[model samples]
Target: MSTTPRARVGRPRATAGSTQLAPRDEILDAAAALFVENGFAATTTRAIAERIGIRQASLYYHFAGKDDILVELLERTVRPSVEFAKTLREDPSLASAAALHTLAVRDVETLAAAPHNIGTLYLLPEANRDRFDGFRASRRELRDAYGAFAMDAATDALRATWTLAELGAAIIHLVEIVIPLRRDGEMIDAVRIADACLRLCGLDDAAIAAATGR
Candidate 1:
C-alpha cells in the first residue's frame, strides 16, 4: 500500500513559464516571432526550444519538427476563412455581395488576429516545399472561394471586364494587405477593407453599405 504509482513514460510536458499559452501554443508563438524577425531558415529547433525555455525534445512532443510547426502555422493562415467561406456558400439568404463582404471581413480579421502576424512567413521559400502541400491546397481553396464569391458579387459590367480568376485574386490580395499593415504597425479595420473589396468588384456606396452593414 505504501508503494508509489509508476511515473508516466513518454515525452514530458513543458514546465510552466512566462507565457500563458498552453505548451504547444507557446512554442508556436515563440517560433512565429523568431521566424519573422530572424528569417525562417535561420531559426532552428533548438532556438525555438530556447525561446520557450524548454528542452528541444519537449518540442517534439508537440510537433514532429520545425517543418511540422511551419505547416501548421501556414494552414492556420487560411483554414478559418476557407471554412467560413464554405458556410457562407450554403446560406441562400445572403446575397452574393453581402456574402463576399462577410467573407472578406472574416479573412481580414483572421490575418489581423494571427499570433505575431505569422502570415508574414507566408512568402518563405521553404513554405513552397512538398512538405507544405497540404497548406498550399488549403490556401488554394480559400483563393477559389474568394474568386467564386467575387464572380457572384460582380456587376454585369465588372464581370464582362474581369474574369473570375482576376476578381478572386484581387479580393484575396486586398485582404492580405493586413499582413503588411500589421508589420508596419498600421491600423486594421476589417469593415473598411471588406468595403474596399466590394468596391473593387464594382459595387457602389449604397450597395457596399448594404453588403457591409455600415
Candidate 2:
C-alpha cells in the first residue's frame, strides 16, 4: 500500500504580533529590550524567545545562545557611528570642525534612536567580561575617531592643555551624557550636543555656527 506523505511543519507565529522583521531581526529587537530592562545575566534565552513569541529552540537558529545575542546587540549600538566616522575621516573636502560636528550629531542620533535606550547596556557589569572585548575594541575605535577629529579641530590653547587621548575621552563623555538623558526620559538635542563638542574643541560662536552650517 502507498503511504501518505507527512505535511511540512513551518515556524510558529510570534506571540508578539506581526513585527514585520525577519526572524533574526525580531530576535535581536526582543533581546535588546529584555537585556536593557532585565539585565544581561538575569535574562535567559527562554525569556527572550517568550518576549518574541517564538520557541527557545527557534532563537538558536539565528544565535548560538544568549551571549551571542548580547554581543550582537552591543555591536549594533556602536557599529553605525563607527562606520560613519571612517567615512568622515576619508573625505578631503570636509573641514575638521565641520566633520567633527557632523560625526558628533550622527553619533548622538545613533544613541538617542536606539530602541528602548539600549546604550544603557554599556553600564551592565557583565559587559566587562571577555566575550564583550570585541565591543569594547569597537568603542575604542570610535573614541579614537572622535579624538582625531577633535584634535584637528582644536585651537592652539586647547591642544596645549590636553592630550589626544584626553580630548577624545572628553568628547566621548560629552556625547554619552545623552544615555542618561534618554534613560531619564529627557529630551535630547543632537545638534546641541554637536555644538557642545565644537565648543569643547575651543570653537567660538561664529566657528560653531559655521561648523553647524547655521
Candidate 3:
C-alpha cells in the first residue's frame, strides 16, 4: 500500500446545528448595532452583513429580512419587562407604589444591560407595520401595565388633570430618554431616576425613599 495519510485529530468540527446557530447570533448582534445607529428603516442587510464580514445572502439564511431582525431584537429587549409587569399584576399583595418603584428599577437595569440603545427602535416608523404586530402588542401590554401602576399613584385631581394612560406614557418616555443618556456615560443613577418618576406621580421624597428603598 502506498503511504496512507494518517488520520489527523484536532478540535472536533462544530455540529451542523450549532454551526448554523453561530451565524444567526452574529447576524443578530450586527443588526442590533446597525439598527440602533441608523434606525431600522435606514439599515440594510448588506450593511449588517458587511459589519459582520458575512454575505448579505448569508444574513438572510438566518433571518427572513431586516424586519425579522428587528422583531427578534424587540423580543429580546421588551419581553422581560412584559413578563415582569405580568408578575407584578398578579401579585395583589404588593403595594402599588412599591411595585412601581421596583418596575422602574428593573426596567432601567434591562435597558442598561442591552448592547445598543433599544429605545431608539421605538421611534421607528416601521414599528407600526403589520409585520411587527407582536412587538406592538407586547409594547402595548407594557404600557397598560404602567398605566395600572400610575393609576395607583394618581390622586383624584391628578387623575382628572392627566389620564392614567398619559401618566404611564410619560414614565416610559422618561426611562427611554434616561437609558440612552446613561449608555452615553452620563452620571445617571437608577434609584434617583426611579425616585424622580415617583415624584411625577406625586410621591414625596420620604414616600419615594420608602417605596424605592432608597
Candidate 4:
C-alpha cells in the first residue's frame, strides 16, 4: 500500500518495473499524472489505464474511480507545503528569515506549478473550502508562519512598514504580473521581480543570482 508515485523525495511510490504494475500502485500513479495534467473534468479512467499499459479492468481493480485519484493527488501536492511551513514558524531569526524566504519562494512556486491542473480544479469556489479538513491546523500553522516570516523581513526594511498582510499582498501582486507572461512563452524579467521582492524585505541584491538564480 505504498503511496509515493515517483522515485524522488515526496514522490508517489512506484513499481520497480514497467512490465507488470502492481494493480493498485499502477492505477494510482497513472491517475495522478493524468489528473495533474488534464484535470478531473477531462481525464478518463480508460486513459489512465492505457497510460500504465494496463486494461481498464485492471484500473478498477484498485481505485474507486477518478475522484479518488484527484483527492489523493491534491493531498500529495499540498501536504508538503504545510510541512515546510512548520520550520519557518519555529525559527524567526534573521538568518531563519533569509533562509525561509529563499526556500518558500522556490518551493511554493514549484508546488503551484507541479500539477498544472491541480490549481484550477481546486480553485472552484466552495469545492476546495474543506478539501483539507483534517489538515486544517497545518494550513493555519503555515499561514501564521508565513506572517511571522514577513514581519521579520519588514523589520529589516524599516520605514515603519505596513502590516505583513499588505506587504505580502503587494509582493504577490507584483509576481502576478510576471507569472502569466512567463507561462505564455515569454521570458520573465526575473531579475526585476527578485530585486523588487528582496527590497520589500529590506534586503539588497549583492547579486540576486545567489538567492534567486536570476
Sort every candidate by lDDT, greatest first: 1, 2, 3, 4
Lowest lDDT sum, 10 consecutive residues, model 4, at 8-17
What lDDT score goes with residue 195 in model 3?
A: 74
Model 1 spans > 4 angstroms off:
1-8
CA shift of 214, model 3, Å: 4.1
Residue 194 in candidate 1 has what lDDT? 89
Candidate 3: lDDT over CA atoms? 0.76
Error of 2 at 107 (Å): 0.6
In model 2, which runs have C-alpha deviations exceeding 4 angstroms?
A: 2-17
lDDT of 2 at 9: 83
Clashing pairs in 1: none
TM-score-wise, the better of 3 and 4 is 3
RMSD (CA, angstroms), candidate 4: 9.2
Top candidate by lDDT? 1
Q: What's the TM-score of each model vs. the native?
A: 0.93, 0.92, 0.80, 0.57
lDDT of 3 by residue, 102-162 (tens): 8887887787777576666776788888988998788777777877897887566677788
Between candidates 2 and 4, name the one with more favorable lDDT: 2
Per-model lDDT: 0.89, 0.88, 0.76, 0.55
Question: Per-prediction RMSD in angstroms?
Answer: 2.5, 2.1, 5.6, 9.2
Best by TM-score: 1
* lDDT (C-alpha) at residue 7 in model 3: 95
